[model samples]
Target: MNTVLETIKNRRSIRSYLPEQISGDELETVLEAALWAPSGHNTQPWHFLVIQDKKKIDDMSSKTISLMKKSPVDWIQKLASREGYHLFHNAPTVIVISGRKSADPLLFPLADCSAAIQNLLLAAESLNIGTCWIGLSKFLFDVPEEVKTLSLPEGYHPVYSVALGYKKEQLRPTAPARKEGTVGWYRA
Candidate 1:
């Protein structure tokens, strides 16, 4: 199999991370890989806010935990209990992805940003760097003003964020097996 296929097959969502940081070059390479993903009409409707500051990480985590606590779901309550209120798994770096707020803002930008995240994850896998999609940033969707502080242009918004770093351990969970033929392909 080709290297790309191997990378995809081995790629895993990394939640646990070490205190070490990823080098500048490796970070750039991963970001570059993300930007190369196809965008709708080449709008490139995506913005990445790379947050490495410990304070900012803590702030975001606090907010996410607060929101999760408010959630009526029992699973979230249980998760917060075991995880101790911190989200993003204490990853050393967080990349916040956002885009413009258009009539179909989410549809295009979400897809684009998701693709970019996937590219970055694959790239990180190749470089032995680990990344996991972060839900903390998205939890702040309740407050639009905070999103603006991220320097997103007018109408722009944050779609998703991914945490990056050198993980101290591998997550024990494995990807669930794909159900083939779930989506039927038909030729008439």
Candidate 2:
């Protein structure tokens, strides 16, 4: 396999992380990779909010868990109730990704933002940094008051978050088996 393929195969959603923070250079490199992701009509409507403060990260995790406990989904409530569960998995750094509202109806900022997230994940993996794409943060984002704390620019809304840090374990887990019959071919 080629370099990209190898990296894609090796990348995994890391949940356990060391308490030590990632280097500034590494974070910057990962963010830069996100900025290069393809966007709809080249609008490039993504914003990144990097939070390195331990207190703030922990608070966010706590708040998110509180909200999750009220969720109708049984699994979410159970996960939230789990002892020692942290929304960001206690990573030293958390990044919130937002997408700018587009005037054009055809443009989908969420898709663009998702592409940026994938790039961010791949870049972090390439640097041997642990990362987890935090969809659970959406619980916090749904709350207007919680989102106001982020102070995002006008017309931008939070879409996803990523937790980043050094892995607690040096050994990488093997990739899980992929689902079968998911691919289709259309050849002329």
Candidate 3:
């Protein structure tokens, strides 16, 4: 198999990570890939916040769990009680992806930002860095106070957050079988 195909096939969402910090160069490479992702009409609507401070990351996770505790949903409440339930899985760094409302039409900015996130994930995988897109913790960024704490600019809204670190586990699990009928071809 080709190298890019191999990378794509092997990339996995890593939840367990070592305590070591990712080197600055590796972080830069991943961010660079994000910056280069294709955007709608070249609008490039995404903004990234790279948080490396463990204390700050922990506080964000705590706030997310706190909010979860008040939810009417049973599953959410249960998840909040789980032991060792840090939203980032104790990863050393997190990159928060956001989009500006004015960057494009309502949906385009989000689509562009999502493309950038995929680029970031693939780049990290190539660098032997582990990444997991954490949708559960995005609630932290949705709150008015949390948005202010994140220091996101006016008009910018949180789309997603990703945890980053080096994998602690040596053996990566193989990819599961892809869902059938998820693809189709157009022929003339």
Best by TM-score: 2
Clash number by candidate, in order: 4, 0, 0
Model 2 spans with C-alpha error above 4 angstroms: none
TM-score of each: 0.89, 0.97, 0.93
lDDT of each: 0.80, 0.95, 0.89
lDDT of 1 by residue, 41-104 (tens): 7878788889898788888778777777777888876776664556777888889888765576
TM match of model 3 to true structure: 0.93
TM-score order, best first, reads: 2, 3, 1
What clash pairs does model 1 have? 98-158, 99-157, 100-156, 101-155
Which lDDT tens digits does candidate 2 get at residues 1-188? 88888888899989999999899999999999999999989999999999999999999999999999999999999999999999999999999999998889999999999999999999999999999999999999999999999999999999999999999987897779999999999999
Question: For candidate 1, what is the TM-score?
Answer: 0.89
Candidate 3: list runs displaced more than 4 Å.
103-107
**Which candidate, 2 or 3, has the higher TM-score?**
2
- TM-score of candidate 2 to 2 decimals: 0.97
Can you rank all candidates by lDDT, best first?
2, 3, 1
